[model samples]
Target: MEKIISHAISERVEFVLIAGDIYDKEDQSIKAQVQFYKEMKRLEEARIDVFLIHGNHDFLEQERDRLELPKNVHTFSSDVSCVPWQSPTGTKIHFYGFSYDKRHIRENRLGDYRKHGDADFHIALLHGSEETKASEHDVYAPFGLKEMKQKGFDYWALGHIHKREILSSQPGIYYPGNIQGRSKKETGAKGGTIVELSEMGATFSFFETAPVMWEKKQIVLEGKADRTEIYRATDELFQTYRDTLCSYVIDLEIVTEQASKFDADEWLQLFEEMRTESPFVWINTLRFIEKNQAVSDKWYQGQFLADELDASLAELMEDETFF
Candidate 1:
């Protein structure tokens, strides 16, 4: 976060926009608040403004302010609100946002946003996941992508979806994702979005901010591929890119057919060897995948039970080491 703020300061960005979910918990400790403010104060000193909306997990209580913020930090109200900011270059930007008052918001808050300013660029800061007709997900501000697209906002900066995704490009709708990944489930490139606005509109791109990366790499070999080849390839690939990744736990699953020479002991040994050489590489799982190719075979069509037994024994026989 300090590095990110320093980067913004060096770039002399007009303003910083945080859609929501500043903290993992709403009852953030004083130390955490101090650390967060310490970074924000730097931007405040640099004459750069910041706009933030508190997400469901980071809502303010009815109690008096829990943390004090600098003059430059402007947070949106619990109700939908808009703030018009005039850039140093005399460009007007209308920013619409709202902080979550509760942990779960079932209502579609998009209707609450009333576009009021004649600013050159109009943008919305939303913190919710897109809802589908058949989706079983918790309805947090239930809304559809199509409705959001037709809302007339020039750009939509979204949050709540921890994985970065761009729903649209023309009138940009983006989820910057969480800056830091907390778990293995949240893997891959974790970072924030950088939006550059002009007469053409907002051009958005994602930049890596997490010091450590969380990634899942799946490695599958062909039916006739050598076991040694798999070990060598996995070793070389990790060794080649290990330095670039701060830390990673790769979940590896192997898929093979009758031609495969399988060895659980050998694979486990290789995993150990890699960990000894590169401690950052943690192999989570080694799975054997069974494809439906056997069931589709003409020879196995009418003999389901017989074919199942043969296929299972074939796989076992291929892995047998004892005489």
Candidate 2:
């Protein structure tokens, strides 16, 4: 949420639209709720209006009724509503949205929604999955891009999915994915989408403001095994970040079959010393494994034992306290 707000500030966006699922749960702690309100207040102070809707996680209930929000924050209830605002670029925009009353809404909510007729630009904010065989998401509240386009919406801002995607080419249908990745599975660059509207048409831009960045790097440790090769691989990985001035939560996976006298403990110690030299770089997860092929009949029990020792060392390198 902070990243979204910061990006909006930097880009000087007219207003921010949160389709749904603002909070992970309705019963979140008071501290979290308060902090959320504070950020909303900050956006409100900046004259930025926020249009929000309730998703499965943050379903509207009596508990949410008690909490107060800033005037700039407009939340849709059971009834569909349209809020009109003028952008700094002098484009008149109309935002139409509604929240799901229940966790599983089978019906197509967009069908009941009234269109903003004759508006310069009309945006429909919804939190549901598009009907597609390839989609692994629930069929609940299903709607299609063609259906949305036929309904006369200029742009459809969708949520509920954690991966950013542009669904339609003509009418400009988009899913902003998620504000931040909650786990490693939702790794890589996760962020929101920015929309620009005008009398001619609408254009879309992606803004990545995720607080925690996730990056996966594969380091090949093949051929002659030596300390120099390991050091060189680390340097290469670090050099990849020269273009993007951003700190990364990196998961380094080293694939090799070569074995040397240096044990896992020694390798970890060297990495720790290198980390001390450059505290800014972080190695969240490290996986080192030996690449093996088919076992030949000529391989004896002694060779098997040696291979087992190499695997053990690789596993030990994963532990931070191995040194």
Best by TM-score: 1
For model 2, the superposed segments whose C-alpha errors exceed 4 Å read 84-92, 134-140, 242-245, 258-273, 276-279, 292-323
Q: What is candidate 2's local distance difference test score?
A: 0.71
- Each model's lDDT comes to 0.75, 0.71
Give every collision pair in model 1: none
Mind sharing the TM-score for model 1? 0.78
lDDT by residue for model 1 (55-118), tens: 8778767884677899899999888888988989998989998888887787788898777859
Reference-based TM-score of each model = 0.78, 0.76
**How well does candidate 1 score on lDDT at residue 111?**
91
Model 2 clash count equals 0
> What is the per-residue lDDT of model 2 for residues 1-323, given as tens digits with 9 covering 90 to 100?
77778778777778888878888866767777788898888898888988888887676775454458899888988667888877777777788888877776656777776776466778888888777553333444678767788987777888777778888745768887776776555677777777876545557788777756777777767675577887788877776665564556667766666643446565656655655332244667776655553135325548658776765565444321121
Candidate 2 similarity to native, TM-score: 0.76
| lDDT score, candidate 1, position 229 | 67
Q: Which ten residues in a row are the worst by lDDT in model 2?
A: 314-323
**Alpha carbon lDDT of residue 290, candidate 2?**
57
